[model samples]
Target chain A: MHTAEVLASRLGLDIAVAELERLFSQPGADPPDYGLDGGHRRPIRVAYQGVRGSYCHEAATTSFPSAAAVEAFPSGFWMEDAFSTLESGSADRAIIPAENSLDGPIDRNLDLLLRHPAVRITGELVVPVNHCLLAAPGVEISDLRRIVSHPQALGHCERRLQSLDLEVEEVDDAAEAARAVAEDRIRDTAVIGSRIAAKEFGLRIMEQSIHDEGGNYNRFLQLGVGDGPLYCGENRKTTVAFSLEKGVSGLFRALWVFESRGIRVTKVDHRPNRANPVRLVNRAGGVELAQMDYVFVVDVEGSELDPRVAAAVAGLGEFSGFVRVLGSYACTCGA
Target chain B: MHTAEVLASRLGLDIAVAELERLFSQPGADPPDYGLDGGHRRPIRVAYQGVRGSYCHEAATTSFPSAAAVEAFPSGFWMEDAFSTLESGSADRAIIPAENSLDGPIDRNLDLLLRHPAVRITGELVVPVNHCLLAAPGVEISDLRRIVSHPQALGHCERRLQSLDLEVEEVDDAAEAARAVAEDRIRDTAVIGSRIAAKEFGLRIMEQSIHDEGGNYNRFLQLGVGDGPLYCGENRKTTVAFSLEKGVSGLFRALWVFESRGIRVTKVDHRPNRANPVRLVNRAGGVELAQMDYVFVVDVEGSELDPRVAAAVAGLGEFSGFVRVLGSYACTCGA
Candidate 1:
């Protein structure tokens, strides 16, 4: 009867009418299967840090067209491996969670961008962070004794899980938890992961979107291995990381370069220059030493071709840490 | 005989030495409550979001030299009221959780910062997050029918809480749970909050840190009405929020303002821009229109007085949505 139901029926997309009710019961909620969009243009081999049906995987599907062959990694550390796959002749691109709507920035991802100067911000995909309580086929709610998932997933599902009165367990990832259930590690075990994982792994959706805080979305970055596509009519975004030298006013002098140069910084963020700490002196003549890690990210609106932007960064003296230029790309989704 | 016993006596302060080891121990892998710096600070008026002896009050006492008055706010929002009071002639300053190392950023507090731009960041404090299952004086875990606390607090104690095998209820805060027992609202109900709440409100510590994740420390922000000590020494830090206008290209443009200016950023993070959504446009077409609201939070190496820092920001132009100079206090502790 619903338009989405008709679309689902025609597309042969495995969308259940009842499941749609659960995820979209709230007003303004969109259907899970965004169906196929001409926007993606081509098939994208997305590299995420988890197994199939994970939230990352779901996000990748939304960002790309036909994620037929997904390359998976065990931890975030392997994202570079995936990125390398994109860089070399293996994969097309990678999908990495730059930040979470609920949890702030994923620090490791930020560190990865800083450490690996090659990856550039091509485009971003925002995915709703909806998680569900899943159980294997034939199992019912009464059969569940323990619930497992990533810690945050567990946190999100706490209220619903508590209502079920099941034992809670912590796992490395939601997909892994589902995998555990598939292997029949414990008949009473259930996992809090994506509904897609539930469907892929043949787990029933016991519950969904248990997070008390609504409007959860994850901003994912699409990284191009090489110099990305030039901007046309599309919106654009650029990302970079830099830092200052150490001294009585070293950092102060460093910042003055930007203001003097006449550049508008859209985003400026930092991560400990994992490389080093700085020495600081206090009023009490207390000398405390710390290897200062450099601040690593900055973004803005404009073209690198702008002479002012180029001259500004050059003016800063010897940066004690890294100063990198990531990349600039056109935003595909036109607002 | 023990370190706490010796320290309590030496401090010349009224420190109620509880058996922390015994107090924090659990039946199978309960969390540890590495006693915080509380019970050591010089007496002062420390405001908290709960009744006397609440965990926050405990944190406040530890923060000061000798806390003379432990002011209790009904909720965290009231703590904001208290911060306003400190500004409008009531309290001096207040410490609030910005993030938990284990759980993640205290998003609510960050949201608060976005609203109350006047609050300045004084310094950062680290407090070990400990969640305990508490019961009334005469009751035990087995007699408990329901466990209650703020949602995240309950999640931290999820595993231990699951093990208790009791029903769960949601409450406003930890001390409220303690107050539940103190007021005799639920005779057999168990509260999962802080150990300080148990002792302060005369409840029993049924179990310790229920959170499965062990490395838990909440990052507390000391906020005041106006400018704090400007020069944060070695570990000196600054917090500011900004936004970008359209047509941003190359992160270099953004970084040029900072890197060229010599002002180093320590952390760069993104928040949803509630006012303006990130515009996405494709050459042909892709996803529909969207406007995202976001705020960029940055931590610099020094005070705003740093000329380079000011110039860089000036260059940042209209791309910056807002600029709130948090504070210029140096960290007394070595990074």
Candidate 2:
């Protein structure tokens, strides 16, 4: 038996490299069937934002390493497209970027998750970004004129690229930028992007480990298309998005939901509300045009199935727009 | 009316030109007191991490703009020293940068804020940054051998600085960088800093508006030595810091506190929980070292006095190792 397979078995997990390879290579292979008291359980297909070379792809791979093949989406907006795919019996799970260590929170994605309240937290992936500067093979630094990459990758490598004295142009994604450098449109130009992008687009690595910190990482969430997992590790985490109702004291009352129990929270983020539109309405009409309800993303300790978590979700329904749970999953504490 | 004062009154906020004038003058004055409650509330002093000519100084001026005055510290760490001052009744508040639009969150400051629970968010200041490359009179880019500034300032102007072929030296803040240029210890050394620092040190403008985004701004939070005002406007926001209790599910249950309340949070940041130090017991006993807890900084829409907020806080108490109200105040919202 392989070491990885042995480790997986010792941990009581059904993961093996060969199993994962087969799952991804298969076409809509039915996942393991687990019979519930009511009926047969349906396996899920998940979607996420980003190109093939994006770290998010790695996150999706981590979620069900040995399960049936799942579908992937191109962008976060397409995750909504995945929702339609799920409705059409194609995908059942959607993964999203909820927060990051350096970036703080992914507010826009939170809005998307809240817009789709049916999704639940099933698992999570923490992907460390190892950004690499890439160029055409055998291309030297002094020969470069312009450096291109995603706007975010640009921000991450700003210091290093500025030192290289290259003209920095923003691109949609690092992988796309790598593709640009490969097309040979501009011989002297290079791309400030990811190693994944370089390896994917057949570009050469010019420099590696350019981020200001070596610990740059992002947290990806596995969002269930329906009710969440029934059981998870004791260290599981859950997410909920909410908006408060009236009464100056209602916010105070809401705190009782979790602190009333013993469950703890790990993180939270807030963004412009997507549900209730705030409009520049004529005072007499009070009409909604754009948005009114601002959403709050909360990450708490414990799975939704836990009694405390279940009670809190059910209890907090007194709110106006408290209608979303992004995901919940067990996490390794030490990592 | 003074230009800044005119801007303040037109903005319909507590902005005074006099406080700004004082800030530009001395090293030690009580930090400005932004009216926390209203026209009747006592003013709160703010301690910021920088001298007269730093972005933090500008942020402090905008938040308070009235008597008690402004106190400036030399480094970001000294802001904590100033926080110690607030803790010891030497200063009334501290304004620290929590995040920036371009560079992402200040991880160190977030970690610091989490460790210091006594300090609360009394108010917030949004300071527009127009970074410029400053140098000595008659100095040209060709003559420059080194560029110095805070890491953040260097980062802010990273793209524009390419091709200069100068060695980048990181300093504590813009003021220090300007000081270094003025002392002439490092000839041919220019500083990428603020106009305030440039003017204070009599440095010439080497480059104007070097930031990639013209409207780049940094978000600063005013932390008061005392509790927040008795009441706030209907549009006030509440801040809280918490650590999950041991064996707690972690982040999501705490989220349910707000999710159930119908309360919406505007921002949330994770800071290292310093209170829980790693304990080392004698090797014979094998007593486990204490694990570090993660601190969450949450800004929700509403005041602490709100019942929903009360319920949220109450509920949080059960799962939280520690939870405290940062503060609440009305501010200019995007709406």
Candidate 3:
């Protein structure tokens, strides 16, 4: 009997033994290829938004454990700066938070991905978020009158912060908020940030893991310039963005191409097409319908190099106004 | 010849005449029912985040032109407060921004919608966003050292603001930024906001329509307590949220039900399932896979009362762990 089945039986879990066997028998359980060449021509540098102790910085370091340097960009407000750094060849890879389990998609990065066509998503890292309330040393919880953090972090801990009854202030970065509290000696203000930020800024962690719920995770994507390498593996996931040629049945037909090919779609999202924002659909009664054009981004369970995936993309091109394969990378098994 | 055909031919547009005819022949182009009882029980009070000059305020007033009272909530940071007002019977309706053309989905409100099950979306309005640069009276543009506005406004005007080379500060609301500039007499800071905000706050318009690109719009949804009325119309659009019982072919099968029923899906989005955030998939080799669970939200081109839509939703329930019909309302044709 499989170890998983034994464990499930012991735990009285209703999971099927056949499903466990299938999952274990799946190939390509190896670590994902981040498209890094082995030769060390120069020290590898990864660029990420925010200062050294931010969650993004932690994502960068964790994604590239042995990287020689992790460069920090001052502005967390704009994700474009990180993309530009990668596009300009200043950094080997740029890591940006793509989505939060609680807050959903980090849209600014998604928009930047569409805008920067050359940048390819090479790998993804799912970091468990544990927001901490940090304040200056010698400050008690009762002394706090206000709380500060990034909008996403604040949102993650909204219920906790509301119970605290502190005035909430949003900044571009959680580490910046921690730095402000520490450097400015704001005894009355606490920041919702990471433990790393508290340690780096010499601030006391008043509360640890203060997020509203357990299992908070942030998915971060590692982006590299151009098409670096094709991931050849069974557990590969390909992301593509496309716009439909027709209105009503466009998306249905678009997804049909994959379904007919026996491809499994993992996720689907839509973003407004920045280049072609509107389409004027004129009617018989002179009623001009200005419809918002959308670019649908989908993730399928195969690499683009796979024959089936290639054929499915080619088929998508038939009915789509435009289709671009963003990237195909090995899927991470767990957070 | 139809007027649309004549206009298309004169403008040298490659639009098909048959398509135009079909569009015009489509039924139900009447204005939507806002769910107002048309009784004088009490002044129709609508609650929205931000003050009178904010975008949410504009969406509320525009959605209900004859609303006697528009209540302003102080906290624009949290969308939950606006929803709570409607849930607690403090307001008859609540209006909140759903999506922005350039910035994409307003995720906070989407998260709030999932949390507040009792609140139902009754109507929608697409407001054209015309952002302006506001500053203190008699303050020249050259004298400004910093710019302040809501994060979305700052993002929309990023390119224009980058060209100005001023420090940027993000506030909770654009109107609040304008108010700060006017009330505090901040001569060195300009704000990216609306003309309404400038007029209300007594700030001068430094520049008009300062957004980066044209066709800027914000889609707003009006929410009320419970399912007030079943929209019975040809142009009705229904929004639904569901979570699949299985993975892989789950979403495809879900969409297939709608497509087979001839229901046109207008939009698709995914939100993290807060109640059940993670699913533990155990494998034979003792590899435990913790996958993030998601709730899929879809908008289809029919009301729940429509038999076809109802049948499709029932079909969805067969394979869905959870299903919710958020609302059905008349479709807004243009921005």
Give the candidate number with the greatest DockQ. 3
B277: Cα error in model 2, Å? 18
TM-scores for candidates 1 onward, in order: 0.51, 0.49, 0.75
Fnat for every candidate: 0.12, 0.12, 0.45
DockQ, cand. 3: 0.30
Task: State the RMSD for candidate 1.
Answer: 15.7
Q: In candidate 2, how many Å is residue A56 off?
A: 2.3
Candidate 2 lDDT (Cα, whole model)? 0.58
Whichever of 1 and 2 has more DockQ, that candidate is: 1
Q: Across residues B1-335, which tens digit of lDDT does each residue of candidate 2 receive?
A: 67965655534323332333233222233554455433332333456776766877666655443435344443344656656766776555666775565444556655555556676666555455677888888888888888878887777677776757678888866677787777674558888777767766788887877876433556666666455343533445777778776522366666667866888754555654444422221212232222223577776877788888888988999878888876765433121
* Ranking of models by TM-score: 3, 1, 2
TM-score of chain A of 3: 0.79
Candidates by lDDT, descending order = 3, 2, 1
Per-candidate count of clashing residue pairs (backbone under 3 Å): 75, 70, 0
lDDT of 2 by residue, A138-167 (tens): 788888888877776777666787688778
**Model 3 CAPRI rating:** acceptable
Docking class of 2: incorrect
Q: Which model, 2 or 3, shows the larger TM-score?
A: 3
